[model samples]
Target: MRKQLINPPQIYDGSPFGMSQAVIDRASATVYISGQVDWDANRQVSCHNVAGQLKKALANLTTVLEASGSSEESLLSLRVYVRGELGEFIGDIAPILAQYLGESRPSLTGIGVSSLAYPEILVEIEATAALK
Candidate 1:
Protein backbone atom coordinates (compact mmCIF):
# COMPACT_ATOMS: atom_id res chain seq x y z
CA MET A 1 0.00 0.00 0.00
CA ARG A 2 1.22 3.45 -0.87
CA LYS A 3 -0.23 6.64 0.61
CA GLN A 4 0.19 10.33 -0.13
CA LEU A 5 0.51 13.09 2.42
CA ILE A 6 0.91 16.86 2.59
CA ASN A 7 2.05 17.81 6.02
CA PRO A 8 1.28 20.67 8.39
CA PRO A 9 -2.20 22.02 9.02
CA GLN A 10 -1.26 25.23 7.30
CA ILE A 11 -0.75 23.39 4.03
CA TYR A 12 -3.82 21.17 4.17
CA ASP A 13 -6.50 23.30 5.77
CA GLY A 14 -9.63 23.33 3.64
CA SER A 15 -7.83 20.93 1.30
CA PRO A 16 -9.90 18.06 -0.06
CA PHE A 17 -7.31 15.48 0.96
CA GLY A 18 -6.63 13.65 4.22
CA MET A 19 -3.10 12.35 3.80
CA SER A 20 -0.99 11.90 6.91
CA GLN A 21 2.46 13.47 6.64
CA ALA A 22 4.36 10.82 4.77
CA VAL A 23 4.24 8.70 1.64
CA ILE A 24 5.02 5.09 2.21
CA ASP A 25 4.42 1.84 0.36
CA ARG A 26 4.84 -1.83 1.07
CA ALA A 27 3.89 -4.13 -1.76
CA SER A 28 4.97 -7.32 -3.47
CA ALA A 29 4.81 -6.17 -7.09
CA THR A 30 4.72 -2.56 -8.11
CA VAL A 31 3.82 -1.39 -11.59
CA TYR A 32 4.81 2.08 -12.63
CA ILE A 33 3.06 3.58 -15.64
CA SER A 34 4.26 6.47 -17.70
CA GLY A 35 2.28 9.67 -17.84
CA GLN A 36 -0.83 9.33 -19.95
CA VAL A 37 -2.50 12.05 -21.94
CA ASP A 38 -5.59 12.35 -24.12
CA TRP A 39 -3.96 11.11 -27.27
CA ASP A 40 -5.85 9.11 -29.81
CA ALA A 41 -4.68 6.25 -32.02
CA ASN A 42 -3.21 8.78 -34.34
CA ARG A 43 -1.09 10.09 -31.50
CA GLN A 44 -2.86 13.41 -31.38
CA VAL A 45 -4.24 15.05 -28.32
CA SER A 46 -7.99 14.67 -28.63
CA CYS A 47 -9.16 17.16 -26.07
CA HIS A 48 -8.77 20.79 -25.21
CA ASN A 49 -10.54 20.63 -21.86
CA VAL A 50 -9.61 19.05 -18.58
CA ALA A 51 -12.64 16.78 -18.35
CA GLY A 52 -12.16 15.24 -21.76
CA GLN A 53 -8.47 14.82 -21.22
CA LEU A 54 -9.05 13.16 -17.87
CA LYS A 55 -11.49 10.68 -19.38
CA LYS A 56 -9.06 9.70 -22.07
CA ALA A 57 -6.14 9.54 -19.72
CA LEU A 58 -8.07 7.27 -17.40
CA ALA A 59 -8.96 5.09 -20.35
CA ASN A 60 -5.31 4.79 -21.24
CA LEU A 61 -4.46 4.00 -17.66
CA THR A 62 -7.00 1.20 -17.71
CA THR A 63 -5.53 -0.18 -20.89
CA VAL A 64 -2.12 -0.34 -19.29
CA LEU A 65 -3.52 -1.99 -16.19
CA GLU A 66 -5.38 -4.60 -18.19
CA ALA A 67 -2.28 -5.45 -20.13
CA SER A 68 -0.57 -6.09 -16.83
CA GLY A 69 -3.38 -8.35 -15.59
CA SER A 70 -4.38 -5.85 -12.96
CA SER A 71 -7.24 -3.45 -12.42
CA GLU A 72 -7.95 -0.20 -10.71
CA GLU A 73 -8.39 -2.01 -7.44
CA SER A 74 -4.72 -2.87 -7.55
CA LEU A 75 -3.68 0.73 -7.78
CA LEU A 76 -1.58 2.04 -4.91
CA SER A 77 -1.09 5.61 -6.03
CA LEU A 78 -1.70 8.11 -8.81
CA ARG A 79 0.02 11.33 -9.83
CA VAL A 80 -2.02 13.81 -11.83
CA TYR A 81 -0.73 16.84 -13.68
CA VAL A 82 -2.78 19.58 -15.22
CA ARG A 83 -1.79 22.60 -17.18
CA GLY A 84 -3.67 25.49 -15.65
CA GLU A 85 -7.21 25.48 -14.19
CA LEU A 86 -6.41 23.16 -11.31
CA GLY A 87 -9.84 23.57 -9.71
CA GLU A 88 -11.73 22.50 -12.79
CA PHE A 89 -9.52 19.50 -13.36
CA ILE A 90 -10.02 18.37 -9.77
CA GLY A 91 -13.79 18.73 -10.05
CA ASP A 92 -13.86 16.67 -13.21
CA ILE A 93 -11.38 13.95 -12.21
CA ALA A 94 -12.20 13.48 -8.53
CA PRO A 95 -15.70 12.19 -9.22
CA ILE A 96 -14.37 9.73 -11.72
CA LEU A 97 -11.87 8.49 -9.18
CA ALA A 98 -14.61 8.20 -6.58
CA GLN A 99 -16.81 6.24 -8.92
CA TYR A 100 -14.10 3.87 -10.11
CA LEU A 101 -12.28 3.37 -6.83
CA GLY A 102 -15.36 2.73 -4.68
CA GLU A 103 -14.30 3.00 -1.01
CA SER A 104 -10.61 2.71 -1.78
CA ARG A 105 -9.28 6.08 -2.73
CA PRO A 106 -5.69 5.30 -3.45
CA SER A 107 -3.04 7.79 -2.44
CA LEU A 108 -2.82 10.56 -5.02
CA THR A 109 -0.99 13.74 -5.82
CA GLY A 110 -2.09 16.55 -8.11
CA ILE A 111 0.27 19.04 -9.64
CA GLY A 112 -0.78 22.17 -11.49
CA VAL A 113 1.54 23.51 -14.12
CA SER A 114 1.65 26.03 -16.88
CA SER A 115 1.74 23.63 -19.82
CA LEU A 116 2.19 20.09 -21.09
CA ALA A 117 4.23 18.42 -23.78
CA TYR A 118 1.30 18.63 -26.10
CA PRO A 119 -0.42 21.95 -26.49
CA GLU A 120 -3.92 20.53 -26.69
CA ILE A 121 -3.36 18.15 -23.83
CA LEU A 122 -4.98 19.53 -20.71
CA VAL A 123 -4.11 16.83 -18.26
CA GLU A 124 -1.76 13.91 -17.68
CA ILE A 125 -2.05 10.99 -15.30
CA GLU A 126 0.42 8.40 -14.11
CA ALA A 127 -0.21 5.48 -11.83
CA THR A 128 1.38 2.88 -9.61
CA ALA A 129 -0.29 -0.45 -8.98
CA ALA A 130 0.63 -3.11 -6.52
CA LEU A 131 -0.05 -6.72 -7.36
CA LYS A 132 -0.06 -8.67 -4.18
Candidate 2:
Protein backbone atom coordinates (compact mmCIF):
# COMPACT_ATOMS: atom_id res chain seq x y z
CA MET A 1 0.00 0.00 0.00
CA ARG A 2 1.11 3.52 -0.80
CA LYS A 3 -0.07 6.52 1.19
CA GLN A 4 0.32 10.22 0.48
CA LEU A 5 -0.51 12.96 2.93
CA ILE A 6 -1.85 16.08 1.29
CA ASN A 7 -1.84 19.62 2.62
CA PRO A 8 -2.96 21.70 -0.33
CA PRO A 9 -1.33 25.10 -0.66
CA GLN A 10 -4.76 26.65 -0.94
CA ILE A 11 -5.75 25.59 2.54
CA TYR A 12 -4.30 25.98 6.00
CA ASP A 13 -1.53 23.50 6.79
CA GLY A 14 -2.49 20.96 9.40
CA SER A 15 0.87 19.25 9.70
CA PRO A 16 1.63 20.98 12.97
CA PHE A 17 -1.17 19.03 14.58
CA GLY A 18 -0.44 15.67 12.95
CA MET A 19 -3.22 15.99 10.45
CA SER A 20 -3.58 16.54 6.72
CA GLN A 21 -6.27 18.24 4.77
CA ALA A 22 -6.68 14.99 2.88
CA VAL A 23 -5.01 11.66 2.21
CA ILE A 24 -4.32 9.68 -0.94
CA ASP A 25 -4.11 5.95 -0.42
CA ARG A 26 -3.51 3.32 -3.04
CA ALA A 27 -3.94 -0.04 -1.43
CA SER A 28 -5.23 -3.55 -2.04
CA ALA A 29 -6.55 -3.92 1.51
CA THR A 30 -7.71 -1.46 4.13
CA VAL A 31 -7.68 -1.94 7.88
CA TYR A 32 -10.51 -0.65 9.96
CA ILE A 33 -9.44 -0.35 13.57
CA SER A 34 -11.84 -0.42 16.45
CA GLY A 35 -12.07 2.52 18.82
CA GLN A 36 -9.19 2.32 21.25
CA VAL A 37 -9.56 3.73 24.73
CA ASP A 38 -7.06 4.31 27.52
CA TRP A 39 -7.11 0.74 28.70
CA ASP A 40 -4.01 -0.86 30.12
CA ALA A 41 -2.94 -4.51 29.80
CA ASN A 42 -5.07 -5.34 32.84
CA ARG A 43 -8.14 -3.89 31.16
CA GLN A 44 -8.18 -0.95 33.52
CA VAL A 45 -8.61 2.70 32.63
CA SER A 46 -5.09 4.02 32.43
CA CYS A 47 -5.88 7.69 32.93
CA HIS A 48 -8.57 9.96 34.22
CA ASN A 49 -7.94 13.30 32.53
CA VAL A 50 -8.55 14.02 28.89
CA ALA A 51 -4.92 14.62 28.01
CA GLY A 52 -3.65 11.59 29.86
CA GLN A 53 -6.35 9.31 28.50
CA LEU A 54 -5.72 10.60 25.00
CA LYS A 55 -2.04 9.83 25.32
CA LYS A 56 -2.69 6.29 26.45
CA ALA A 57 -5.35 5.80 23.81
CA LEU A 58 -2.90 6.83 21.14
CA ALA A 59 -0.45 4.29 22.44
CA ASN A 60 -3.09 1.59 22.26
CA LEU A 61 -3.90 2.67 18.74
CA THR A 62 -0.26 2.37 17.78
CA THR A 63 -0.13 -1.15 19.20
CA VAL A 64 -3.15 -2.11 17.16
CA LEU A 65 -1.59 -0.64 14.02
CA GLU A 66 1.63 -2.58 14.48
CA ALA A 67 -0.30 -5.78 15.23
CA SER A 68 -2.15 -5.30 11.98
CA GLY A 69 1.15 -5.16 10.10
CA SER A 70 0.86 -1.44 9.53
CA SER A 71 2.61 1.56 11.02
CA GLU A 72 1.48 5.06 11.84
CA GLU A 73 2.64 6.26 8.43
CA SER A 74 0.08 4.00 6.82
CA LEU A 75 -2.73 5.62 8.74
CA LEU A 76 -5.32 7.11 6.42
CA SER A 77 -7.51 8.84 8.93
CA LEU A 78 -8.49 9.13 12.59
CA ARG A 79 -11.77 9.83 14.31
CA VAL A 80 -11.34 11.10 17.85
CA TYR A 81 -14.14 11.01 20.33
CA VAL A 82 -13.96 13.34 23.31
CA ARG A 83 -16.33 13.23 26.24
CA GLY A 84 -16.13 16.90 27.16
CA GLU A 85 -15.57 20.30 25.58
CA LEU A 86 -12.95 19.97 22.85
CA GLY A 87 -11.84 23.57 22.99
CA GLU A 88 -10.67 23.08 26.55
CA PHE A 89 -8.54 20.08 25.64
CA ILE A 90 -7.27 20.78 22.10
CA GLY A 91 -4.37 22.60 23.69
CA ASP A 92 -3.35 19.29 25.24
CA ILE A 93 -4.26 17.09 22.28
CA ALA A 94 -2.45 18.81 19.38
CA PRO A 95 1.08 18.67 20.75
CA ILE A 96 0.79 15.06 21.88
CA LEU A 97 -0.58 13.98 18.53
CA ALA A 98 2.07 15.89 16.58
CA GLN A 99 4.84 14.37 18.66
CA TYR A 100 3.45 10.87 18.33
CA LEU A 101 2.85 10.88 14.56
CA GLY A 102 5.73 13.18 13.61
CA GLU A 103 5.65 13.88 9.87
CA SER A 104 3.00 11.27 9.16
CA ARG A 105 0.10 13.67 8.81
CA PRO A 106 -3.17 11.83 8.38
CA SER A 107 -6.65 13.22 8.06
CA LEU A 108 -8.14 13.69 11.56
CA THR A 109 -11.51 14.51 12.98
CA GLY A 110 -12.47 15.37 16.56
CA ILE A 111 -15.98 14.86 17.80
CA GLY A 112 -17.45 15.88 21.13
CA VAL A 113 -19.62 13.23 22.68
CA SER A 114 -21.57 12.87 25.89
CA SER A 115 -19.57 9.84 26.98
CA LEU A 116 -17.47 6.94 25.86
CA ALA A 117 -17.29 3.17 26.50
CA TYR A 118 -16.17 3.77 30.08
CA PRO A 119 -16.93 6.67 32.37
CA GLU A 120 -13.25 7.13 33.10
CA ILE A 121 -12.22 7.11 29.46
CA LEU A 122 -12.15 10.77 28.55
CA VAL A 123 -11.02 10.06 25.01
CA GLU A 124 -11.31 7.33 22.42
CA ILE A 125 -9.72 7.13 19.00
CA GLU A 126 -10.58 4.97 16.02
CA ALA A 127 -8.37 4.78 13.00
CA THR A 128 -8.34 3.64 9.38
CA ALA A 129 -5.17 2.53 7.71
CA ALA A 130 -3.74 0.77 4.70
CA LEU A 131 -2.17 -2.59 5.33
CA LYS A 132 1.54 -2.82 4.87
Best by TM-score: 2
Error of 2 at 63 (Å): 0.8
How high a TM-score does candidate 2 get?
Answer: 0.77
Off by over 4 Å in 1: 1-28
The TM-scores of all predictions, comma-separated, are: 0.73, 0.77
Model 2, residue 65: distance off in Å is: 0.6
Best by lDDT: 2
Candidate 1 yields a Cα-based lDDT of: 0.68
Q: Alpha-carbon error at 56 in model 2, in Å?
A: 0.8
Lowest summed lDDT over 10 consecutive residues: which window, candidate 1? 5-14
Compared with the true structure, all predictions reach lDDT values of: 0.68, 0.75
Candidate 1 has what TM-score?
A: 0.73
- Which pairs in model 2 have colliding backbones? none
